[model samples]
Target: MSVPELETLLVADREQVRWITLNRPDRLNAISPAMLDELESVLTASADDPSVRVLVITGAGRAFCAGADLSPGPGDPDALPDVDLARSDAVFELLERQPQPVVAAVNGMACAGGLELLLCCDVVLAAAGVPIGDMHANAGLLPGAGGTYRLPRRVGLNPAMWLLLTGRTAPAEDFLRWGLVHRVVAAGELTAAAEELAKLLSGKSPLGLRRMKELVRDGLAQDRRTGLAHALAVAQAHQKSADYAEGVRAFAARRTPRFTGR
Candidate 1:
């Protein structure tokens, strides 16, 4: 189930980080069916491996992702297109469900489904001057991927509605103001910034980070009492882990801990 190197998406692992790059710079890194399938398979592979602690997704060149590849329109132009929107969503869900942290380094124009993809990331870093638009409405369409749902949750109801309804393009400043992007950096500094953050996060106990992501994501849907209860349970469980004991010992000795991800 490994992805062929020539596909529109490319995945590589370094240290504990799995770097995923959109390779179709010629088409603005548009996602094709093979690309979508490869993305899912690669994500699953990373999730299953304990050595992977973080996943960084970015584009090859100018654009992060221009959206789906509607060019060939799913093999045949005459037949009804079997566009698998579900497959796209499965990728999104994989991002949400993955135990490791996922960071999206938005290099350039992230519009339509591209913006949706950004929303799926736990943290999004955008390059300066990069513009993002939700062009579904302008093209007489709507977000099929988790855009309508995740966009509102990230940016708020009013702003999300306006963007989706008007299909307006937002600059990097606007994205920062709307809280869509976690950080914004100069164009050339994009990779460095994201890598710095990734390095910092990767230094932590892997299980702690995974549980934190799970708690926040799953706890949001519960009542306050239930959420707190779940948090306590998670804390108790972690306290019993080997990494937690090492963390305490390292703290008392005033030294950095080498976490084995127990």
Candidate 2:
């Protein structure tokens, strides 16, 4: 599918993997009103496009995203429109609910809202030497985009508490150790590594990937018995899909399965 023109986002599709780059390099890709609007529209469109099997989000310049644009451009008539921070929650929600897996490629600094944005992704890969932190505390504010809930789940409660309470930045390696990041690579290899992972994901059964994502995400909030029941129900339903029959036939034939995502 052809990508729509967007002022704040650069969209590219390669082998069923859609890469969305935050394009305001001068502002470190900070979240502005226009950027948020464009992002939401693009994400919504990508979700509905069956051709897009996976998505990777990254920034253009020195940072993945510095955070929200809170500074008013005083005396500058060309300033961006006032950002409605509340809309950020909706954007994050849209990302979480997408059928395709979303990966965050943190090329550099990811703080406050930027870090929160990464937390919404299913997989997170960061470049070495990148500084990551929750800076909401430093600004006398709290995370408004599911950070409080997602952070604790990504890292342990203690680490999440320390990061959120202090708003101190740490190296990407620290996050990798803390289990917040899936991989840490050299800055020059960040995009390549993310694309490699996206390519691998794009080759999987689209229905299987979507169902597995749903099972894990939704099961996390359920009791053990309830989670098991849901998993069984999902498995049973998947057995009736064409992909499952193809998988079985391929196993019997000793060949790779060609999943049509039916």
Candidate 3:
């Protein structure tokens, strides 16, 4: 299938996985307001398309994203008028609410707002040696995009505080210990590894994936009892899905299940 034409992004579909590349190599794939708009449009389309089962977001050239584009061209139509919490929150919410799983393939430098963007992904895989950090403190600023909350949830309170306070960039491998990164691969293998993971996830039942993602994300803010209750409710509801039946029959038949994502 032909991929959609986009100026700030290069998108492609393979084996039901949609790969969205941040394509601003000169700026190290910095997030301009135009890029944010393009991302929202692409993600909205992917969410509505039944063929798209998973999403892998990465950057072009040497960096994943160097943060927001503070300097935009005069002709840039999608440039944000200002950097504010509401705008940042909206973008992050768009990312988090997508039904399909979103994976961040952090290929290189991910700092400041870039790191905040990565936090929105369901899974994060980073290239070894790539630097990652919360750099807002360096600029005498704070994380405006779910970073303050998401960072602590991902890496724990103390680690999040250290990163945010120091404004120091650490190698990607360092974050694996903190659970900020799911996997760290050699720089050359980053794309392939991310693709492999995305394909693996895409083959599963779509309903199951979406529900599980929702449960985990929502459960984070709830008490243990409340979270368990939510999980049980989802499990009960999923029993009525066609994919659930196929999964059970396939297990009994010793065969691979064909999930229609129902």
Candidate 4:
């Protein structure tokens, strides 16, 4: 559902997919401080809602996101007293930990914080020829919102360094080859393509997807053996779920399974 007060975001729910569009086309949908708070709020809500099986994060207009707004807005955390330093990065971390699988619909240019946003999501479907980069160096700023850590882990050290160092943009094709973007479609087809993917994900069992997401995200931090152990543990627990039983029954019955997210 759309929140009228959200100045920088346009949120809507179509079926089980929650589309969170960064609005501020005039500003190229830059991540202002207000935008970060709104994003955190929306993401938190989506994570809590059982009906929201998938999330598609995109931007309005020609650009996905141009990165952080250089001009500080009113009530900036840095300008406030007794500010929680950890709060700054918590928004980015929340996206990473969010249970729903996120699909980033990268359109136009996604740079700096935009790239950081992509790294948090599970998969990225970018518009063909869309350029993405970590251009913080050009702006005399370092990526403070989990970009440096997530970027390298996602695209390898050399490729990550190339973007972080050069402050130059590469076509979406480059990112797809680098294992960052999942797929690329034409600019006009981006929204429809993203919606198609979201709907595809929405048809699956929510509980199953959430647990699988947890496995992949958690396993990434552990050794192969430890990760395998964790996966087995998760699988053992999941076997007792109603969704699992329904899945088995539906397979035997040769029908589409109905999952209630249990």
Candidate 5:
């Protein structure tokens, strides 16, 4: 099924995967205030829709995103953007908090806010040689989303510091080594690669995936002992779930499990 027509994005659903493509190729997919609104709506819908088991984000043309629209608008010609920065940042946050897994297909350049956008995804796959960086420094701006927070956690502080401070775009391969990108593929294969990975995730137990995501994300903020305790609690609860029972029965029967997500 199609989503409401969007000016700045395109949507395609297949095999329980909802693919969202940034449609502003002419603008290098630079996110405007309007795009943020449309994107937030899509993200919310994807989260609530049971058919959407995996979400993939990519961009049209040669770039993933150039970041936020900093152009002058009717409200204030001098202001960077008339949009509410907090509201705009919340859109990215919504993506981060999605129940199902989110995959980022970085086809090309991803800078400034673009970098922050991808940081929220659960899995990231980039085109080989694709340029990526925190262009905020280059533009005399700062990331309003979770860029500063999530980037360091994924790539470690030293690498995050260099990228955030220098604003120098590097090939996606560098990020793969730094543990930010999960894989780097040829430019021509980016979408197919992302969808393949999404397909693998789509068949998993929904409740199990959701629980594990919440557990790991929440545990990142706790000490080792505390995190282990939290995991134990979660395990106890999960064992009582329908999916867990089905999994064990399937193993005994030597057949695939049918997860009901209960």
Candidate 6:
């Protein structure tokens, strides 16, 4: 979809890159049930599209995402709508299951559910002033999203514990030091930096990149021997692919390889 068709969110396609923006600038791009549903659908749809080589999520306003919308209404409880977690499972599933890479351009405060979304992305780019926090416990609410699980894996137990327990906010620099974000750039430079990284990642063999993400995610749970065996199988499969041959040929010709992800 082009820029105008985008309503609550904007989906822009530029040379195999799909840029998704949370368009609720007035509310700091808060996560409403409808927003969550749309985000899941869009990401999942992009996952199946071979034309989309990379996916980037960002916010339209100054803040990336301020967490769930606590607007008052009949269905709204404690500000957030009472949508079943299952309804938005697609968001987490798409990120963890998709073959294409996902990046989050966290330009502003990304807290609670917003932070969880960032955690699911393969690469995270936060602006210098943006603060990342997990405030579920502080708010007297458990993380209905993926926060409870993914946080520890990304930032490790001790650091994750400190943040989770204290409900403290961490700046971009702190996250960079702890390896939460891939990079921290200036405010206006966030999107460009993220896109540059996406382009660099997209230039590689699509299948290789996909498999690498899958293995890295899955390997953490597997024993070393089993992980090695799985790695060998994946490596062998890629070695036999037509794109592998094309990669070799391109190297010989000193030209850019056109990977079909076969």
- The candidate scoring highest on lDDT is 2
Report the alpha-carbon TM-score of model 1 versus the true structure. 0.94
- Candidates' lDDT values, in order? 0.86, 0.90, 0.88, 0.88, 0.88, 0.83
lDDT of 1 by residue, 117-145 (tens): 88888999999889997888986877888
Across 36-61, the per-residue lDDT of candidate 3 in tens digits comes to 77887887888888899999999999
lDDT of each residue in 125-146, candidate 5, tens digit only = 9999999999788867777887
Steric clashes per prediction: 0, 0, 0, 0, 0, 1
- Over 1-262, each residue of candidate 6 has an lDDT whose tens digit, in order, gives 3122445788888888889899899999988887877776787678778888888889997888988876776855657556566654556666667788888899899988788788888888989968889887787877777777888888988888888888878898888888889888999898789879889977888888888998998898899999999999999988999889999999999999999877
Tell me the TM-score of each prediction against the true structure.
Answer: 0.94, 0.94, 0.93, 0.93, 0.94, 0.92
Q: Answer with 5 or 6, whichever has the higher lDDT.
A: 5
User: In lDDT terms, how accurate is model 3?
Assistant: 0.88
lDDT of 2 at 260: 83
For each of the candidates, the C-alpha root-mean-square deviation to the true structure, in angstroms, is 1.8, 2.2, 2.9, 3.1, 1.8, 2.4
* Candidate 2 per-residue C-alpha lDDT over 104-155 given as tens digits, one digit per residue, 9 for 90 to 100: 9999899998998988899999999899999899978889888998999998
Sort by lDDT, top down from the best: 2, 5, 3, 4, 1, 6
Give per-residue lDDT, candidate 5, residue 219: 93
Look at candidate 2 and give me any clashing residue pairs. none
